[model samples]
Target chain A: MLRVDVEKQLGEFSLHATFSSEGRVTGLFGASGAGKSSLINMIAGLLRPDRGTIVIDGETVDDTASGIHVPTWRRRIGYVFQDARLFPHLNVAQNLDYGRRMNRLAPDAAQRARVVELLDIGALLDRRPGKLSGGERQRVALGRALLSKPRLLLLDEPLGALDEARKLEILPYLVRLRDEANVPMVYVSHDAAELRQLATQIVMLRQGRVTSFGGVKVLT
Target chain B: MLDISPAEWTAILLSLRVAIIATLVATPFGIALAWLLARRDFWGKSVLDAVVHLPLVLPPVVTGYLLLLTFGRRGLVGGFLADHLGIVFAFRWTGAALACGVMSFPLLVRPMRLSIEAIDRRLEQAAETLGAAPFKVFFTVTLPLALPGVLAGMVLGFAKAIGEFGATITFVSNIPGETQTISSAIYSLIQTPDGDAAAGRLVIVSIVLALGALIAAEWFAHRATQRLHGN
Candidate 1:
């Protein structure tokens, strides 16, 4: 379960949002500058909310009134940015192993193999991210996040940087992730079609406000 | 004409020792300062920046005199250190190294600061989301990515240290084996009546060392640029 009721002031724009979802994949649908990213960042503990609380999986990650704010790393959440920000100095295998190392998790070869197989990134493991195509980089980023064993995965337009062909290539992998990964996710995107295909519940935003909340029907 | 004497060899060897020691000792402090300057904005930041660069612009003799006051045997910091730790810098080779390190610090830190600034902060955020704490993010991501530039900085610092003359001579005085580096040795030789040939040889050695350092710094800087491109 993920819950958020937060107010933030960012210069000329102020975001006031409240929503709770237990859905496997809660989609935040909005256009650019619709505050979807800000909302997701708040959940990830990257942005502190001026007022209100955020609860993830029954744990109070952020509560402004109580002055409880869990840092991003301690929150045990995964984030995939739009640009697929891979560490340039590390090879794909090292990048994938980074989260496990940082979290002090025992190396699970079975889980590693499973994620590699699921993402079809085994062959690319030895290559640096600089060598990967856009689609391949995104796949590697997904594998990197999944191997971390995060409670909640926040993806901000993972396909936003891809071309049409690359998007088609990666969408099926995302669908498989939704069906099999077993991690609850907050998927943010502007395309209604994308949300309709993946999101079990939809929260629509416009200009920093939640305009609608419901099933995928609200996306239309 | 190319013959080198034993006393000249001592000066050459001493110069290398002073420069190598200075560069190694100053590196950690340089990296820390560079990261602070690159990633943070605090009160007195500009003042700190200016202080770090002071040695670069201040007259070398003035810097040396300040070092004398702070690190001399009877001076404030030096007196305390001498009484407590039995470490002394006044009129010693160690004092020469200290002077070289201070003079080379700005050169050492510039490349490091630029490299840290060039890193994509978003990558650090990504590391944080993946469970790396702040320090881990620095070691694993920021430091490694900035390594080439760090090397460049170190090489530049080493070059500057090897050639440091004014501050070193002033701080430690030109004691023959204790504090006389290549530059001070050359200065001494140039003033002597029969010292032209030896001075010429030392000058050539200094030229070679400086050129090598410059080339290495250039190569590392090139690598730094490429590293940022993710290649």
Candidate 2:
């Protein structure tokens, strides 16, 4: 379960978003500059809201009234940016293990193996992020995020940087992560194709406000 | 008798020592300052950034004097350090390092800050969503992406330290066996009769060292960039 009631003012464009979701994938659909990213950023704890309450899985992550704002690290959320931002120095395997190691995940090799095979990045593990193609990099990023075992996965247009073919290639992995990982997700995108193929819920935004929100059926 | 002249070898060894020490001392500070300037938005950040770069613009002698006033025996911080910790810095090799580190700090911070700022911060945000803590995101996503710049900064700083003359001479004074780095040795030799031969040798060494630093920085930054571009 994810609930966000955030109000932030960036210059004159005020973002006041309030929504809740418990779906496999919740799409924050909007046009460009519609505050979808900002909304998602608030959920990720990257941007603090002026007044709001964000509760995830019955945990009060943020309640500005109570002055309780959990830091991003403690949020246990995984975010995929529009651009696949992988560590350049670290190879694919290391990048995937970064959060897990930092968070001190248990010494469960079985779980690690599952993530590697799930993303099908076993072959590319030894290669550096700087050496991979766009599709390959995004896949590795997805794998990295999944390895951390995040309770909430925030993908802010993760496919935005890829070409058409790369997007097509990587979209399935995202969908699989949505279905198989069983982790709830908040997805931000303007593309309808991804919404149809992935989103189980939809929350539409315009000018930084939640304009409409309903089932994936509304996407049609 | 040692095969190498005491003056020549001592200067060589001291130069290397001072440069290494300066690099070690400044690198971590440089990276931290760069990251702060790049990522965090706080009050007086620009002022802090300007202060970090002030050594580059200020005359090295002025910087040395400032250091002296702050770290000198009778100086504010210096008096405390000496009385409390019994540590002495004036006219010592450590003082030379202080001078060198100050002179080279800007060269280290600039490249690093620029590279860090150039990183798409959204990616770091992404890492956060991936359950990476702030520190983890920095160590994993941000630091690796900013690495090429960090290496460039280190090289630039080392090269700058090797050539540091004004601040070092003013802060430490060119002692024969202790604080006499190559540039100071060259200055000392130039002031003496028949010392042109030694001065010329030290000059050549300085040129070689500085050139090597530059060449290495360029080569590494280029290669790292290529790798970053996935080529």
Candidate 3:
């Protein structure tokens, strides 16, 4: 369960967005500067809304009335940036292990092995991020995000940087993550094709608010 | 005839030791300051920016005097350290390092700030959603993305420390093998008619050291950028 009703003003642009969903994958489709990223940032707790409330898994993550705002790191939410910002200093293996190490829980080697196999990135473990190709980098980024075992995932244009071939290669992995991983996710994108393959629900935005939000079958 | 005296070699070694220590001591501080300037906006930001760059703009003597007032033996903080911890810093090699670190801190911080600012903030937000604490994101995402700048800053700081003279000499004085450094050595040599050859050798060494640092910075920045973009 992910709910957001955030209003923030970034300079001249006023972001007033409200939405709620429990879907496995919810796509937020909007043009550049339409406040899509801003709304996403609010959910991530990186940007504070002037007023609103966000609840995830029945817990109020952000609420102005109660003055409760969870910091981004403690939100149990995962976000994937458009450019796949993998750590340059860390190799592919360390990059994947970062979230796990940070979770501070006892090491779950069996679960770790499953994610490694699911992502099919075991072979690229020893290589540095600089050595991987565009598609491989995105996969490593995806694997890194999943290894954290997020309760909710936020992907902000994860495919925006790749070329056509790279997109094709990584699209299947995202689809698998959505369908099989079963984690609730918020995906922001402008490309119709990507939404077609990955999004289960579509939340369209124009200006700074949601224009329409419904099952992807409507857009399809 | 022997090329140099034992005192001369000690000065050389002392200079090297002080500069290295200064840089090492300031590296973490430089990164933290850079992160603050780049990521957060708060009250008196402009004042902080100016204060950090004070050593770059003020005369070395002035900077040294200020350091002496704050960190000199029997000085404010220095007095406390001397009284309680028995740590002495007046006219010592440690004092030289303090001066060098202060003088070169801006060099270490500016590049880091620029690189940190250049990084996409969205990635950090993404890490946050993935259950990364602020410190973890800093170490994993923010710091990694800003590595090029941090590396460049460190190299520049090290270079600046190596070349530093004014504040070092003013703060610790030219104490022969205790506080003398490359630039101080060169300055002392130039004062005498027969010391030209030694000064020239140190000059060549300076150039070589600076050139090497620049080359290494370039290689590191390139490799880091490639690794980040997964190129």
Candidate 4:
């Protein structure tokens, strides 16, 4: 479960939003500069709101009134950016293990093998990120995030940079993740069709305000 | 055949030792300072930056004089160190190394700061999202990505330290078998009527040593860049 009610002012733009979702896959649908990424960032504890609070899994990660703010690393949330910022110096296997190591968790061979198999990245483990294609890079990024064992996953336009063929190649894996991974996800995208195909619930935004919130029908 | 006298050999050896010590001693501090300058915004940041680069613009003699005032035997820091720690810098080879280190510090810091600045902040943000604390993100992501720059900075510092003559001569003076480096030895030989042959040999040695360091720096930087970019 995730709840967010926040207000932020960025230079000439202002963002005021309130939304709550218990859905496994909640989609944030908005056009460019519509504050979709900003909202997700706030939820991930990457950005602080001037007012209101954000609760993830019943923990108040951010509460302006009480002055409670959890740092991003302590928030236990996984974020995948549109660019898939993989560590270029590390090979795929090391990158995959990074989150787990950083969190000081005991190496879970079973979990590691499971994530690699699920993402089908077993073959690319020895390869570096620069050698991988865009779609492959995103898969590695997804695997890297998932291995962290996050309470909630925030993906800001995960497939926005890919071509149609690459999107087609990765969508099924995303669907499989939603069905099998069991981690709650907040998916952000501007494309309504993609949201319709994956989002269990939809939150619509227009110029940094949530105009509508409901099932896939709200995307219409 | 190369006919190198024992005195020339001693100067060559002492120069190598001083340059190596200076570069090694300053590298960690240089990286720390460079990282701060590149990634942080605070009050007096510009002032700190200027201070760090002061050695670059100031005349070497002036810089050496300032160092002598602060670190000489009768000076404040030098007196304290001598009284408590029993470490003295005045007219010693250690003082010469200190002078070289100060002269080369700006060269060590500039490339590192630039490389650190060139890194994508998003990558660090991604590391944070993966549950890495700030320190961990720096070590695991930021430091590794900035390695080529660090290498370039060290090489620059080493080269500067090896070539450092003005500040070193001013601070430690040219004493044979103690503080006389290749540059000082060459200067002394030039003053002697029959010492032209010795000075020429020392000059050749200096060029070879400097060229070797530059070539090694370039090779290491190229390899590091390739590895970082996944080439």
Model 1 chain A: worst 10 consecutive residues (lDDT sum): A211-220
Candidate 3 TM-score, C-alpha based = 0.83
The best candidate by DockQ is 1
TM-score result, candidate 1? 0.99
DockQ of candidate model 3: 0.54
lDDT (Cα, tens digit) per residue for candidate 2, span A1-220: 9988889999989999888897889999989999997888788888888998999888998898999999888888887777777866667887888778867887568887887888888999888777788888888878788778888888989999988988888888887787788889889999977898999999989899988889987877
C-alpha lDDT of all candidate models, in order: 0.95, 0.85, 0.83, 0.92
- List clash counts for every candidate, in order: 0, 5, 5, 0
**Of 3 and 4, the candidate ranking higher by DockQ:** 4
lDDT (Cα, tens digit) per residue for candidate 1, span B1-231: 468889989999999999999999999999999999999999999999999999999999999999999999989999999999999999999999999999999999999999999999999999999999999999999999999999999999999999999999999999999999999999999999999999999999999999999999999999987777666
Q: Better model by TM-score, 1 or 4?
A: 1
- Residue by residue across B156-194, what tens digits does model 4's lDDT show? 898889889989888888999888999999999999999
Q: Record all residue pairs in model 3 with backbone atoms less than 3 Å apart, i.e. clashing.
A: A77-B129, A77-B130, A78-B129, A78-B130, A130-B227
Over 4 Å off in model 3, which ranges?
Answer: A8-19, A27-36, A106-123, A129-134, A157-172, A189-217, B65-80, B145-148, B182-224
Which regions of candidate 1 deviate over 4 angstroms?
A: none
lDDT of 2 at B215: 93
Pairs clashing within candidate 1 = none
User: Which is the winner by DockQ between candidate 1 and candidate 2?
Assistant: 1
The numbered model that scores best in TM-score is 1
Order of quality (DockQ): 1, 4, 3, 2
TM-score for chain A, candidates 1 onward in order = 0.99, 0.97, 0.96, 0.99
Cα lDDT of model 4 by residue, A1-220, tens digit = 9999999998988999999999999999999999999999999888999999999999999999999999999999988889999999999999999989999999999988988999899999999999999999999999999999999999999999999999999998899899989999999999998999899999999998999999999987
What CAPRI class is candidate 4? high
Q: lDDT at B76 for candidate 3?
A: 96
